[model samples]
Target: MASLTLPRHTGFFSGSLPTRPTLRYAAPVKVRMSLSESGPSIAVVGVTGAVGQEFLSVLSDRDFPYRSIKMLASKRSAGRRLTFEGNEYVVEELTAESFGGVDIALFSAGGSISKEFGPIAAEKGTIVVDNSSAFRMDEKVPLVIPEVNPEAMHGIKLGTGKGALIANPNCSTIICLMAATPLHRHAKVLRMVVSTYQAASGAGAAAMEELEQQTREVLEGRPPTCKIFKQQYAFNIFSHNASVLSNGYNEEEMKMVKETRKIWNDKDVKVTATCIRVPVMRAHAESVNLQFESPLHEDTARDILKNAPGVVVIDDRKANHFPTPLEVSNKDDVAVGRIRQDLSQDGNKGLDIFVCGDQIRKGAALNAVQIAEMLL
Candidate 1:
């Protein structure tokens, strides 16, 4: 596999690990790795995938205190060399016995892999932060977005000598709710309509590479490759590739709808979504139309969002600048803009907002890491 160029300083290995990826936003302070014999013992499942690489980046950037860390991936990726925090480790083949001493296992290997090994790890007392839809809708599993509902997984902690599963919500759902939850708390959301403009990163590294390749091939006047997506991905937009259900909503669309209800714990809240895949390389932008139970002045909503954790209000009508996928590509905070009262609905009761967030970082790796942080 050819190396895929990722954002600078993110510490992701494209195909092989030759040099460590640099850090863009980490503090000047030297990050301490396994130097000390304290903190949770960590394991990253699917260490060769995009999100797997990101897990290392976030952990290092945040200076997460981990006494020891193991990189686990599929058999094909096993024995590959990767470096994190100045230490080189060989990727290990993931198996039922891999989680013997792992206190926290971050799983992003897809639903099938997660289903097979997630419980096996948890049963061995590892706190599994699964980034798959496999367990998100499970009533027993806590679908968590750290900023929105830390309380949902309240008592889950490391060293319990017991295992648990915490599901990360869909990327679009996380980006949407990061901006919407603040306003929801202020005025109580009655209904939410979300339309996602997602990027190739949401589809994984191969898709990103395919998009880049297609773009190049098209510009070179050659036939574009269409392996990742059946249709041309370069300079094109298409409905999300998730399989459509009997209800006519694809899996991606329904993920947002159902995840919002689960994350918000508001089964009564009406939610609808339409997901689309755009040509952007990273980050996801969402157009949210919200109807509140009580009137929430646009100005008040903006103020509320400005103070929301993990959210940044970028509404600057005078400049005509709003949250763009490129602006939030590798950043942590979800950016919000286009904040205004919805003219289609009653005054101060409905508002429209645009939000952008890095689907790979905050959506998957960072959110799961944040959940791990709460365990401490």
Candidate 2:
């Protein structure tokens, strides 16, 4: 994620003026790697969506090595111009021929698009890192969180002349597991419960815009616009918009439950989640409760998390400062705090924690880029 506050653009090249600027992180060190002619060829599917735009941002921020890059979107967005790595490129309509010479394709388009083109691209021997629910649970597709389970995609690599589909876990699952997995590694998690306060970004750029627009309209004594969602989003919270399943859990909550089990490779691990949409602009916050197989003290858990890669402990009981969505916005590291023993569980076998992460960045683009980096 770029440290500088950037214009909230629909795509890399298009932008709408913001009535209220969202705060983002400033990178302490920016790694600038020049694109090498010998590097892997890259293509970004859904190049006009929010996460698609973010894909470009993360690649540049991390200085990902790429021999060439193509911006791909629907026919509507094709012929558009965008700038990346100090070069101007015209967006091309994604087609069967798009992946011909591409080595790695980062996909953030909706599930339908991914389902159709993901396999087609991979069939061409382009490693497709798909950010959708399409192939997440597919036995053939490796649902990956690079920090948690890079091994899931171990044998699959670039230049194998073999294309494979890799699924990026749901943003909520990615955020929660980033904090819980470290502790799980120390003491096996027998069961896990998660409550998410997701932001509008998870719904796409339109939801974010609706949130902003609704806020202004509500403040002005007008009926809030409800295009992206069914209800007012400015000052109210509601159950996530995902369809409610017969089992009573919405799709978002189930994603957390199922993805956790898959990523952990522990089908027996019990998991449950309640997902809610809050009025935050970006980033998702999670409250996680864990029951471990053996005892793990809160201090030990804290220390483990502090040393964990892609995790930062922000617990400050004295100051009452803990992880907040705003604090983690546009930041790569997931922030974990509110570390304490679960009073409901006996002994030190259980703990509770709060986590926050930029859904678009670490929860999506940054994670995908990290997976691509492993290929090199």
Candidate 3:
């Protein structure tokens, strides 16, 4: 396993705009590499969605080495054209045969598609970095965040001698763990209570439009209709999604609890989460109260997070400086702030902190690409 050195520039593309293609993507060309540098052809499984778009952006922004790049999606999006490296690539309908010559496949489509076709892609000798909940808990599948669990990538054995699939953690889990994992290294994280302010993008592009449309209706004195959600998403927050299980917890909330435990590899670590769908467009924010086995002071906790990998400490209560969803919308580093001792607990053994990160980057596409980089 290799350790990732944190990059100096924390913002996505360091001021480069994804809406406008840079020189890096201005020409129809393949990256030339030596024999050792050369590997396999690359493919993006869900090339039409938000995360899929970010995958393309990161691949270009980081200048990843690949001989050829293929864009694959459902039949509905097959005719769409996407540009990368200054070249236009027509989207192709996803099929089992799509993995014939692909070396690496980054999957961000829903779990059902991954469960159905991910293995076929791997069997055809393609390394898959899946961003879904489908195979994340599978013992054979390695759920990875390059910054926190690069070692998990090593567990992905290429059985077909060409490719293997690696799972990306849930967006909420990824952002939360990036800030909490480093602290766990210093002190045992016995339990955590998190209330998340998740953006509509996490739900999908349609949810974002629903939020906008409903907001317009409400402001115009019209009754808001629920389509993407069970209730009004504009000027309102709902705690329900998909279904509520027998345990009295919603599926999304349960995912956060289980996924966090799996990522940390500590079943003893207790996590209670309230996952709420907010009207924000991009970033995800969390208010976390952590109880440690030993006493951890607020100052020391701040120091730990400030120096931790993949985390940026932005604590300045005097200046009202703290991370916001807008501040972290397009940033890669997880921003931590509002650090304080939890006085409700005895002996000040608990710590309270706030964190925010771009759900699409560290929480999704960028994290997967970073794992592939570590493997290289």
- For candidate 1, list the clashing residue pairs, or say none: 9-22
Error of 2 at 292 (Å): 0.7
lDDT tens readout by residue for model 3, 207-234 = 7667767877898999987888888888
> Model 1: C-alpha RMSD to truth?
3.3
Q: Which residue pairs come into collision in candidate 2?
A: 3-25, 3-26
Q: By descending lDDT, how would the candidates be arranged?
A: 2, 1, 3
Query: Stretches of candidate 1 above 4 Å error?
Result: 1-35
Tens digits of per-residue lDDT, candidate 2, 183-260, equal 999999999999999999999877887888898899899999899899889989999999999999999999988899
Q: All models: lDDT?
A: 0.87, 0.88, 0.78
Off by over 4 Å in 3: 1-39, 155-160
What would you estimate as the lDDT of candidate 1? 0.87
User: What TM-score would each prediction reach against the true structure?
Assistant: 0.93, 0.94, 0.88
Candidate 2 lowest-lDDT run of ten: 1-10
lDDT of 1 by residue, 260-312 (tens): 98899989999999999999888899999999999999999999999999999
